[model samples]
Target chain A: MAKLKNPRGLEDSQVMKMSYWKILSILLLVYTVTGGFLMEVPRLAIVNETIRSLYFHVPMWFGMVVMFLTSTLYAVRYLKKPGAYFDIISVEFANTGLIFGFLGIVTGMIWANYTWGTPWHGDPKQNGAAVALLIYCAYFVLRGSLENSEQRARLSAVYNIFAFAAMIPLIFIIPRLTSSMHPGSGGNPGFNTYDLDRNMRMVFYPAVIGWILLGVWIATVRIRLRNIEDKILELEYEKNH
Target chain B: MKRIISIAASLGITFTGYAQEPEMADGMRSEGKIYVVVAILAVILFGLVAYLISIDRKVTKLEQRLNDGKPR
Candidate 1:
């Protein structure tokens, strides 16, 4: 039998040429070391020195947002093309996004503990973030419980649309309406000002980009693996039959 | 034991004096800063974990498929 070519035509691509895991590791190492050193610097620190957490917390939320946005894109593609690959990519992105969302909440809680004198202050931002995360978690559970691939994909795609729509209000609008000890709320205008100085921005912006790239790199690896697994499963079923 | 007792006594006196002074009562504002740094690091760690897990699941699926195709 002739060898089947990669359907996505990525097998020979430059992106597939390099080891994603190694590149991701190197980027993570650099981010950690540089961020750590910058945080330790005496003068650059803010909010009684708790502002250093911004590097970690803000980036996770940014990464999560990126993942969810990617998921939404794939969901749209799935609706149009009805391909398995798109569904897989969408679910994979959602899984990664949820992990980042949970981290953002944890880090925010820790920051609040020190600055606001408690881990949780019933802040609007906190509550809204929690609700958004829970919605995505439910999406995953719903997908898992379903047995049929086509049904799972269609249902998940529809749910993803709704989840993404709700996310806008939960993450951006609601936080703005109510009181939040968090920087950008309660009539006290958040990070829009020079809250993050030029020096902070130098590291902060790169951290966001790096983390998002890292997220994509991971999702690609996952998609590739899923393809391989499907091929093997097909072979096995053929042999059995 | 005697030296330990003396040290404890000195520390108590120092803390009492610090508490009495309004300025010193604030303790080093540096603690708050450290907390912030820790919180940020925790978030980054979570993102890292998310990335790793996504990759791991894919690899596992691939490996399982490869194994399933082999002859018994």
Candidate 2:
């Protein structure tokens, strides 16, 4: 691996390298897709074979939450240190998070249609997730509206923090408070020994980890591309001046 | 004759007992066709990951080019 100097005097780790986690992500996902379909799932009455969706669908939300959490942390870092690097990281993470969230919602709707009798059940958890994604979408809008790079970074950093805060309660807390059709909410028995039993956890946990790593890898690629763009712009300005 | 008749009846009972299990894709698996599906999915996953890796390599090359004191 060539040692590339980060444009902003950031640590060497900030410079992207082919890491072990990327390999792990690939391996885990391969296992998940294979095992998810073939493995013996609980023969639940309503879900039956569709219960396999748990391995695929649930990971998207888990990956999204992880990405958003990382974004919020970087946003907080930007507030304290005030650097373009942190801001870039924050935005790219949120971008990947949004992708995961969209997949989560789409896959969820498909699974719900067969199990819940409708695509949009207006379940508390579903609404909460939709509301949470909208809040993050507004974060991007907030960033786009500002012209100045510094101003855009600063304002969006604050908004990112707020968005994460709202998402926690909306997606996690509110669903539990209200009677949600979702499992593990509103006194419904979650995927415990009953549903997401020991057999499923073997695949589900790795699937979540694998997907989160994949999301991070994607965000890092975007961040690197953005860095290249910034460097080109800086070099161009220097040449002109 | 009675013994042969009892064996036939027990065979019929066992077949029905086997049918009582929860319906799964056991037929597909028993016929060994599910491996085809697994192979197809694995190939797709590997293909996407390989593509992602290539993009990552391209970005790394760009980073190296810029860091080499040459502006592309």
lDDT of candidate 2 over A85-203, digit per residue (tens): 99999999999999999999999999989867799999989999999999999999999999999999999999999999999989888887877767766644355433538788888
Q: Model 2, which residues run further than 4 Å from truth?
A: A1-17, A188-190, A193-196, B1-22
Tens-place lDDT per residue, model 2, B1-68, is 23323443455455446554435577888998988988998998899998898899778777867887
Candidate 1 wrongly placed segments (more than 4 Å): A1-25, A28-32, A39-46, A187-196, B1-72
lDDT of 1 by residue, B1-72 (tens): 233334434554564564432122123334555445546766776677666655564465445446554332
Clashing pairs in 1: A48-B33, A49-B33, A50-B33, A50-B36, A53-B36, A53-B40, A184-A190
True contacts preserved, each candidate?
0.12, 0.31
Tens digits of lDDT, candidate 1, A77-112? 999999888998999898889988999999998888
Q: Output the number of the TM-score-best candidate.
A: 2
Best by DockQ: 2
Q: What is candidate 1's fraction of native contacts? A: 0.12
The root-mean-square deviation over C-alpha atoms between each candidate and the true structure, in angstroms, is: 10.6, 9.0
